[model samples]
Target chain A: MQPSSQMLKGILEGAILQIIQQGDIYGYALHEKLAALGFGDIPEGTIYPLLLKLQRNKLIIGVRRPTGNGPDRKYYHLTDEGEKTLTIFQQQWHQLVQAMTNLNQGDESS
Target chain B: MQPSSQMLKGILEGAILQIIQQGDIYGYALHEKLAALGFGDIPEGTIYPLLLKLQRNKLIIGVRRPTGNGPDRKYYHLTDEGEKTLTIFQQQWHQLVQAMTNLNQGDESS
Candidate 1:
């Protein structure tokens, strides 16, 4: 079964930022990448709006670039603020993992 | 820095249920356990309401027990429904971890 949307909501932005940090990518490719990475099929509806929000927040900046054979694609890359946010995300994610790990151990020991 | 409240919102219930599953626990002790387990300082404001909600949802049942020196404490235990929910939560949490791990690897290899 898929992770509930509510579960995904908290972390999707960080995941998206991490993807963009690796390389500049457009919307469609980002969706594919998330699916490929086992995030499941996240809809474009969810991703596009987040990209806009990220751009609005100035965490990421998007520039329109030609695909040479199709419509212009808006490629996203991390801003300095985005990079910093990504760092915080990583830290928070690690802390979460640690907490879950400890909880699981508690389960095992009990 | 602590994981933002928004980030914690999605998983806190599952974490709470997991704790309850391990054994019966009361409100204040639950808060301390969460803090000790590295969820950070989640306020009683958050925990009490959630316990109420969990009870209302029938995922947990609370029993009032005498403290002898203080007011009775409502000890919480997971219902069968809570057990099923915890299973789903573990699956979802692992999926999230896998996705994050894959993303982290992409960052490292690229």
Candidate 2:
């Protein structure tokens, strides 16, 4: 089931952090990676602004490098703080999933 | 990892809906159930307000009934709308879990 935009909003930041933690990536590449991973068509409009926010929050750092094909691209990589945040997000996510599973399974009795 | 208040704010509405779907329950019982499910110390100040919002949104209805032991308790039960919302939430949640799982595991390759 695809998520509505509202459902996606809270989880997106953590997804982006997980991606950046893999390796440094540029905005456009990040967009494509999300799509490739079955996230559907997440517009650059959505991702670029989030990247800016992550930068503003000091969870990531961006550096510019000349791309042979065009203008310099800004690449994002996680900071130590980003790693810590991702760890917390992962734990919260797993716990949530487990609890939800138990709740749904127990619905028969309730 | 326990979820922070910020992480939970978005998903709490859905969780509450799931609980109501299980059975009609009052505010205090809902609080205890959440703690039992590992949702950790969610206060009534947080839950009661969300219940009001759900009723306002037409996703749930509340009925006050006398419990032999004490003050009337307001029991919350899901509406048709609540059932629909919970279905969507469950779908979105599972998909998000899959994508996150893939991303984290793929971190080795990226």
Candidates' RMSD to native: 6.1, 6.2
* TM-score, every prediction: 0.86, 0.81
- The residue ranges of model 1 lying beyond 4 angstroms of the native Cα positions read A1-9, A107-110, B1-9, B107-110
The alpha-carbon lDDT assigned to residue B76 of candidate 2 equals 96
lDDT of 1 by residue, A3-108 (tens): 2233334688888998999999999999888878877777899899989999999999999998799899999999999999888777777777877898999832
DockQ of each: 0.28, 0.19
Best by lDDT: 1
TM-score of chain B of each: 0.87, 0.86
Q: Give the 10-residue window scoring lowest on summed lDDT in candidate 1 chain A.
A: A1-10
lDDT of 1 by residue, B27-81 (tens): 9999888878877767899899989999999999999999899999999999999
CA shift of B10, model 1, Å: 1.9
lDDT of 2 by residue, B1-110 (tens): 22222332367678789988888999999988876765556789989998999999999999999989999999999999989978777666665566667787783221
